[model samples]
Target: MIDLHTHVVPPRTPFLERLAGSDPRWARLEPAGETGDVIVAGSNFRTVRRVAWDLVERRERLAADGVTGHLLSAMPELFAPWAPAGDALDYARAFNGWLAAEVTGHDGFFTGLGVVPVQDPVAAAALLGEIAGQGLLGVEIPSAPPGAPLHDPVWADFLGEAERLGLLLFVHAVGGALAATFPHPGAANGVVFPSSIGQAVGGLIAAGTLERFPRLRLLASHGGGSLLTSLPRLDFMRATTPALQELMPQPPAVYAQRLWFDPLLFDATLLMALVDVVGADRVVLGTDYPFMGADPVTHLDDPAVPAALAAAIRVTNPQRLLTSLTAPT
Candidate 1:
């Protein structure tokens, strides 16, 4: 079955030295041991696992895990929203080059979803065209850039270009400011991060992004991030808030059904509920592979889910999304 939500990093390159280019603000990764600390703007942003760069081992393990094909994006921590525009674009091109080369080597076994320097929409759109021309699936973007909302005018411009190019967009949380506001300190337990994805998705729906960009296909990671459970509250709010209704012409849950989601919820009932909310056709297999949350490999075979629905989630749905590999007619 096609796994829609896996990540890969290139074999270690001189990311820092290449982008530093006399700029002190460019982010760098300082290797400590098995993992490395990411330094951005003079502060430790986060730590990354070494397995993220072990491409060959990861490909082999995916086969063993029953994933016939998977999508690869730069590790989210490397998005480097803090970098200056020139450095950020340089990093995007460099990373996309590595990804295209890897996909060319592996061909059908792996497809690429490259990254763009989202802080600059003009550069991002230009680079996105290059990525689509390379036959990669599309682009992976952070839920939002550092301090901006996903539906801001700049993002709208970039997304407009994405839709014109018929590219798919995958939204994964990168633990920005929103992650820090979670009721708990540290937010490292993985709870706050996925919850932030839910909030991001809600924001997108409220902003009428799908309505504005009808052809823009999106895949929301982490079971669409609490979306399945939050629908009742969202709809209730819509009913009470006339202004929100004006912004969201339809119910929030309806907008959710049009987007795709990865089944990484780690529970059978939640998987079933995800299907119930967004339909099996919108749910795809995702392992978050080679990371702490990779276990259980739950293939949506829960007795709670219908056999037909499970098959769709595992196989039928991904085929539709994969069609983006072809130039859109």
Candidate 2:
């Protein structure tokens, strides 16, 4: 089955080492015994196993996991939204270049989602064209840039470019400002920055961004965080709150159905609920592979799910999304 949520990271190449050492704000890969941890702006962000860098091992592991193909993206922590715009752009290109090089050889077995310097929309849009030109599937950006929310006017240019270019945009969470809320923030406690995802997504829907940009294929990671759960509330608020009526063009659920999401939430009940909310076609299999999270292969075996819907989630849905991605001209 095609897994849309897997991640692959390039090894600590010389360029990255140089960049990191020259400026502390840049991400640096510090070698530890048997594995390594990524240090972003002096804080130990996350550890990476050998498989993170070993493509051969990754392919073999995918075979063992019964996954036929998977989409590759850089680790979200490396997005570095706080870095200087030029440095962020440089890092994005490097990550995309690494992704292109690695995935080009694998072809059918692997597709790639590049990174863009989301902090600067104008520059990000330019780089997105270059990324699309490389035949990369699309680019993954943080749920929101640091100090900037998704609804900010600054993102319009980049989002506009995405629509005009027919590029698929993955709004993955990279907890920057929001992480400060937690006293102890990091992956250890599930301090995943997905909480804002719902708000960002809801705002976009309410603001009629999807309606305005009909071709923008937006996907939310982590089962769209609280998006599905918040749908009913959004609908209620829109119906009751007069001010929201102007913002909401249609029922919130209707716009939600138009977006894509991965079944990264391991709970069968939650996964089924997500399918119910978004429809089976928009729900794709996403293992969050190698994270020791939910296994995508076992999604079909969820007790309450029907055979047809399960099959659609495992295979048909992902194929549709992947096949529909705008290829480089």
Candidate 3:
């Protein structure tokens, strides 16, 4: 099995110490040891003991669970999107560079999704080009600004550049930093809602951004947050509205076919629903590993799921997404 959404941070203590001292916006991160473990405290989400597990250790752990490979993403807070663009870019470069160095030695055993300075698209694009050449799988960006809808035109250039580079784009939800008004407030407390991520994705699709860049592969964390439900509406609007029909090459469903969804939905019912909506080929496995509520392998072990579907979710889909990054001469 291949786990597509595990996380790692730079194991260098100096970098962690520097970030803790300089960035008051990060809710006080404290480096606890020399082996790249840090205690991140005072955040809206649950506090976590972030540690860097060596490839051998990680392999052994996964092997115990029958997982053969892992696709590493940087821990969410480490991206520090709230920081100034220049500082964010520096952090992004440092993190990506460190990830490349660590993973390059392991080959197929490990792969990574690079981080980018989302605050500045032009600079982010340049950094992405460099990382892409290094054979990184993709870049991670927030669904939107702290208090703004993701569909805001501000992020267009960043999305456009990603499309041009032929890189996979992963947009994961950040819990506390979501825009002020929750997209859907009626749901029960424990239930998973796809509001913010859905809004961001919907905004991009409605604005014709995906239409403009046909080759871009966008993956949304948390089963793409309400996007599956919203797709039918988007399709209806496209069919009934003549102007939108002209703007979009096909219906919204066609555009969705280009987008990818991760299987972070812990419930078997939801997972099967996502598979029906996005189809098996577009869904990848994401563990959000080491976080309290996320366990990717649990979904893999569910008896409700067919073996063939589980294998595709666990291994085949991730292989296709990462292998797409091979640089052409």
Best candidate, TM-score-wise?
2
Those runs of model 3 whose alpha carbons end farther than 4 Å from true positions after fitting are 13-20, 27-55, 146-152, 177-193, 293-304, 327-329
Candidate 2 residue lDDT tens string, 50-112: 677778877888789677888887777677777778877887888888788888887579889
Which one wins by lDDT: 1 or 2?
2
Best first by lDDT, ranked = 2, 1, 3
TM-score of 1: 0.85
Task: Give the true-structure RMSD of model 3.
Answer: 3.9
Task: Output the lDDT of residue 257, model 3.
Answer: 70
Prediction 1 global C-alpha lDDT: 0.75
- Against the unseen true structure, what C-alpha lDDT does each candidate score? 0.75, 0.77, 0.70
lDDT of 1 by residue, 1-329 (tens): 88788777555432557556665555566766667666656787656676566556667876896778877876676777877788788788888877888777765888889888877877888887898877777899887676577877667888898898888888887676656677764554366657767877888887778778877888898887666777888889989999988888889888888889888787888887777777768887776754544464454666777788777777778877786446458
TM-score of each: 0.85, 0.90, 0.84
Per-residue lDDT over 255-278 for candidate 3, one digit per residue giving the tens place of the 0 to 100 score? 777788887776788888878766
What C-alpha lDDT, on a 0 to 100 scale, does residue 318 get in candidate 3? 77
**Candidate 3, run of 10 with poorest lDDT:** 184-193
State which candidate, 2 or 3, has the greater TM-score.
2
Model 2 TM: 0.90
Q: Is candidate 1 or candidate 2 better by TM-score?
A: 2
Error of 3 at 105 (Å): 2.5
Model 1, stretches more than 4 Å misplaced? 14-16, 20-51, 178-189, 293-296, 324-328
